[model samples]
Target: MKGAMKALRLHKTTQKIVDGLKLETVPIPEIGPRDVLIDIKATGLCGSDIHFIDGSSILPKFPTILGHETAGIICEVGSEVKDYKVGDRVCANFATPCGKCYQCLTGRPSICPNRSMIGVTDDGAYAEYVKTASSALIRLPDNIPFDQGAAATDAVATPFHMISKRSGMKPGDTVAVFGLGGLGIHAVEIARMYGAGMIIGVDVDDYICERAKKLFGADEVINSRKIDAVAEIKRITGDGVDISLEVVGVPESQLQAVNCLRPGGRALMGGLGAAPVAMPNTGIFVRREWEVLGCYAFENLEIEKVLKLASAGRLDLSKTVTSHIKLEDISVGLQDLHQKKGYPIRIVAVQD
Candidate 1:
């Protein structure tokens, strides 16, 4: 605790993600009297982290330690820290809410007016140790491994946030999931569990599409690249899918999902992409009363759902967790992640 711990800091001079970064003699961060010091167990690589490397996050500035989907063990606690103590395995939620805000007062803390996210609005994990508010720490079940907890934050949680919260998919509903990557594949699984009559998986990779059904138990899979994905989906569902979850943030996929909707279909568009494209206004007005939704990060974040899903064996935890690397190998991990050779769901960076 007295000596400095290793950390990867985004270099300010060249705006680059330099690995083997060090904080040779950094201080143990001061507790806010309500914060707890966490001995970071593992951190997951997110597409957003690549944005930080490419200098494209909407976040204000750089020189930040970049990681959000992280889990750790509590090493120290401030006087005001309650319900948590040293040695508790926990994960951090990105949306830190101010209790006094109008949103928080109305039981909507996720959309709190004064929200500051780690890794973007503040310094974050990607270090040996980090500090977070006691309110942010959700204890990990003893049965869960840190490596599994690492990817639980978003890769697993985002689908729950979208399918249930944004899309409002219910039992007996028919759902369409576009772009069967980390979030999309998970969404398909959730759709199946939610008792959707038909779960359609759409992706450019036939391998990923096939894996969606084989591994996650999705009812049907479609390759958007080979066939007219929208037309095929319409043909399968008679009119269209009841709910379409768009995980690829590419504008074309967004349009394609919307175009493939039945009357009153809900389109849940979620992912990390900035490419622009146009959508037809009348598509919703004429036949389908479609809800063109925009989903970013998870809202009203709950760590338990992701863990519980894994714990209950509902999620394909092992299949989704693709790569594991030590802290020193982070840079190489990021590069390989960008290439995405085999459609690994979560690339976790852990300690030796």
Candidate 2:
């Protein structure tokens, strides 16, 4: 707990991912007065981590650790950290928001203008040890496994926000999820949890669509490559979906998600990419009264609800973890995810 620990790091000196990522031993991070040192039990590989490797604007610093969706056991706590103690099981708020900021004070920490994210702006959980403010730590229940805890941090939390906050999903509402990637798949499951009457999962990949139905309990699956997604969605639902979530950051998919929403229905956009989406027709917003809202991550209180659900056995975060590997294989996992080699929802790295 005092000396160096094994870590997967991306260095500025080696910009290319293949040449840059390395398994190295680094000093275990120390905690400040209000911080807690966590002995990482499991960490998830997310798409945003790739941005760090690709030198995106998200990565605020060079030579930073990358895995952000994580869960661990508290190994050490600072003098001011009274709520948590050593041996406590927990997952952290990946975004470090200034508690005094307007967004934070207004109960919207996810969109805090002055926030620093783990992995992107700070040393993250790719290492055996991580240090975070005690305020960011969310207590984990005894029944939940570390891998599921890690996945729930982002994969589950992101969709929770998309459905609950952005779309105001309600019971009996029909929902459509575009893209069957990790986040999108969870959107399908969480929409179901929201008591959606019908859940549709759309993806170009046949494998993903099948997994969405069999694994995530999607009521219907659409292979967009073979059929007109918007048309199919309209045919399935009498008018259109009550709420549609676009999880694939492509302009076409964004358009499809909005087009499939019924009049007065809302759409949640959680995906991100370089391509810009053209504004929808004026009538769609003006006459139809359709709503499109962008969602970031989950709130701290929202994550607590998810963790509690997982603890009560009401939520199954385990299904989202498709693979479990060691830290040394982080690069291989990242490559597999990048190339879409395996139809993985979430790949987690576990400590041996």
Candidate 3:
């Protein structure tokens, strides 16, 4: 805990991710009385990380390590931490919420105004070591590998939160997932796991669309570039889908998500976009009783539930991890994600 460790630090925002991030030796994060120090074993690259690099997402401070989806071993424990000890395998809930805040007290801690997010608001796990509160830690079962455990933290958990908690997707409901990226692709799998009657995946990339159908649980896939996705979805489902999740974070995809919903159906927006999305026609929306809800990241307990599901073999993340790279090659992974080079579902940075 005393010596320096190598981390990929973001000095500034740049379109070129490699230019913005510098891999340098920095002091290991010091722990507080209620904190724990982790030796990062596996971490994942996400679309939000790309958004930070492209200036679409804003960071509170610069020179911060940039990774939130992580799993590791506890190397040190704080004096006041009672539940956890060193050498425990764990994955973290990146959002650290203030327990006394109004949102936290009301059981909506995911949106706590006082919440601090790892990688976004503070130094994260794009390094050899990272530190977070003991409350943010969730025990990882021995059956799960570190890379799968890391992906479960965000790539899988976020969509599970959106579909299971926010979307109101009942068994046998028709579901449509927009964007076949990391989060969206997982949405397809979660929808199927929840017993969706039909799961449709929408994306511009043909490769991702095909993979979602074959590997993930998508029953149908639509490439928005070649055809009218909304019309096709309506034709397939007979009156649009029961639940539509927009994880693309773009105005067009968000609008399409709303449009491809049945009357009184829900549209859960999980993607974060800098631009304002145009509101739907008020007359039609009000008449149809359509609901558009915003879903933030998963709750801390949800991460535990996801881990249990994975451990029980109810959820499969085998294909979710597209590839693995070394910590030094994080920039390359980010570039590959940004360029959609490999149609990656989740590219993880694992210990070499």
lDDT for position 174 in model 3: 96
RMSD of 3: 0.9
Worst 10 residues of 2 by lDDT: 12-21
Give per-residue lDDT, candidate 3, residue 77.
96
Per-residue lDDT for 73-188 in model 3, tens only? 99999999999999999999999999898999999999999998889888998999989999999999999999999999998999999987898778999999999899988889
* TM values, all candidates: 0.92, 0.95, 0.98
- Give the alpha-carbon lDDT of every model: 0.76, 0.85, 0.91
Indicate the worst ten consecutive residues by lDDT in candidate 3.
12-21
Question: Against the correct fold, how does model 1 do in TM-score?
Answer: 0.92
Candidate 1: stretches off by over 4 Å: 12-25, 283-287, 299-301
Highest TM-score among the candidates is held by which one? 3
Quality of model 1 by C-alpha lDDT = 0.76
Candidate 2, residues 1-352: lDDT per residue as tens digits? 4799988888763335555578899899877899999889999988777756765534666678888898999999999888999999999989888889888999888999888777777888888988888888898889888998988889899988887777888799999999999899888888888899999999999998999899888999999999999899999998999999987678999989888889998888898765786458887678888888888888778889998987887778778888998988888888777777777889999995
Ranking by TM-score: 3, 2, 1
